[model samples]
Target: FVHYIAKEMTALPVGARVRIEGLVKAKEHNAKRGTVSRASAPEGRVGVKLDDGGAVLAVRPENLERIDDGRGGTRGKGGEGSNQAGESSSLPPPKKKPSSLEPKQRTLKRDNAILREFDGSPDPNLLVLYYHFRDNAFDCFNSSEYHAQMIRYYESGLSVRLVVPRKIGNNDYFLVGLRHSREDKNALCEVAFNCKRSFSGISMLVKQRCFVCHRAGAPHCSGGCRCACYCPGGCEERGRTDHGRLCRLVRESDVTVEEECMQLL
Candidate 1:
């Protein structure tokens, strides 16, 4: 019969302290007895070998001792060497928990007065215009200047809307509400008035309508009317006869003065 020992128990050093109070089992072994002319073998129990062959049961933990010389004293059972040290020395400190009020402090504050004025308006068109300008603070003119211009236009009975798409380029911003008509829309009117005052040159591209009229033998009608050239019949000939008939027709029509002026331009 042979006794067994655990693998961990066999790993302990010879002098290491341990508590091993447990039952002991017997073991058997065989050996040669005499060596003579005719040798005889003897068979009997010798000692016990633990299941872990590297360890012997004959040695017990009680026989161990602390060996101290110049080095540090040897550790006893469940001593400092059993638990490794210096593991977490370089680890960082735990982070602090964030406060709930921190988010509220960081939130941005909007101008409530402007918001309220826009909110109180009943017209959906007005609200849409407000959002368009409000969202594009950098692209649109400054809010103060835009509001002042809007008030002035409103008081002038123009009922005009500043319609600009969100992604309109900088050059296009000045042309909003003006490009649709070649006449008195704000952009065109501003440009024409500036040109007349010699504040800016009337470039050929900007005065394309005038150039077309001149090329079509209607030079005198350049600034007067677009219909003089753009009307149903092509402008191929120059004549007082066609001119007088167009003038009479324009005067008799029921179109508004503003629309009539645009047609003329």
Candidate 2:
């Protein structure tokens, strides 16, 4: 029931293609974000039919990013259209990308940066961590609910598995970071502690470095077995390669670590 400022927004055309960030379910009209889908309403509050034929949703215009611009020209957010004068028609800004001259992907970067606040061990500076609560722990939570909660914590970007970890005391708790492979493989990393309340009381983590690169910022694990970190970007190769050598480590230690991670939050 929110009304957008008429001057700042316009209806999208039917058949226009838009890309939402995550997965959107059919029953959710207010799903804040999702992937490519077709618009059913062009001007009013954005409603789209997901490409998968799974569900239809009425999304906020701001949440609907036009990938096709509907005029056949591929214009990204901060594209040259604005410079053309008189092209200032109402269409959501193009898909955001990182650039100084263009609209920046602030949301994407912010989500990736959430891990920066956690000062625990296992190297908090490694890769970006996106947490996901699953199965029974998330039974009552729908995609819309999940998306809303995530926005409260992180923005939006590459999704990773965030496992609920064990609690040591009233204040200390850890989260498990997982990376998935295309072949259904999973890697596990034991994240350092973040205070359950204000995140101000992190317990000292003994494993402060990545098992792979042996540098700080060890924010990843190998399939729920062992935790190791790779330096950002060019260093990922070493992280994965090193994990292969320790594939047996998870099997050996999982009796304690893996079971804790797999348990319901």
Candidate 3:
């Protein structure tokens, strides 16, 4: 029934197995200061600092009984590896395996609903579902859960991309910094818009055409009658009354259309 403070513990429930390899002594006192501070106190205070800059108070010595001194001999009155009376075991429960059709059946049911929402013509290749669990850093690129999810998706014969961007600047949204180039930005927007349309039952074709037209630098101009001509770089420049004529000139001339599109001029 021995217990000691561990520095690695964080948000763990009580009665969890915490390994500490050291001796326990009486709590130290600070003689120089009038009032003793926990940080300035010694190790015997039964407190530990976590990795996330947090501290946890350990179980009191009265509730703990030392079985081993971390050396060859036993420091307590009892011999090594002896537990006190009524001390419960700290071992975790054994894990069980899922049935062969358990996971696949669950996924199939969810996919059926997704397909029904898409009028039964949904592209299975474009579908991706993620189930994340608590207890890990989202900032790291290669966490154990992340890698395991990737492997599961890959083994299912699906072509998918898993993106977990770290918090940067003051933006709360992810991928704000990764989409620096116009092409990259457009790709992200297209994915987001398509996902929205698929889930909300909205028409994305009109939106897609509008995006293309905007990129081409042509105003709506009452449907098909565009006021601006088709330019290679799209609708970038503004405030010109004769945008149509300017677009025609750019199209006919050899001046490389740069400055806006992701490709070279």
Q: Lowest summed-lDDT stretch of 10 residues in model 3? A: 198-207
Ranking by TM-score: 2, 3, 1
lDDT of 3 at 252: 38
lDDT of 1: 0.25
In candidate 1, position 24 carries an lDDT of: 26
| Candidate 1 worst ten-residue window by lDDT | 196-205
Order by lDDT, highest first: 2, 1, 3
Give the lowest summed-lDDT range of ten residues in model 2. 195-204
Clashing pairs in 3: 216-234, 216-235, 217-235
60: Cα error in model 2, Å:
2.0
Instruction: Please state the error at residue 2 of candidate 3 in Å.
Output: 27
Best by lDDT: 2
Off by over 4 Å in 2: 1-15, 20-43, 54-56, 65-111, 114-265
TM-score of each: 0.15, 0.20, 0.16
Residue-level lDDT tens digits of model 1 in 6-99: 2111233433322222122321311111111111113311122332343434432211111222222233344334434423234443675765
Alpha-carbon local distance difference test for all models: 0.25, 0.34, 0.23
lDDT of 3 by residue, 187-230 (tens): 11221121221011101111111122322222332322221222
Residue-level lDDT of model 2, residues 56-131, one tens digit each, is 6666553444443323332334444543554444665588554533211111111212333332333333222333
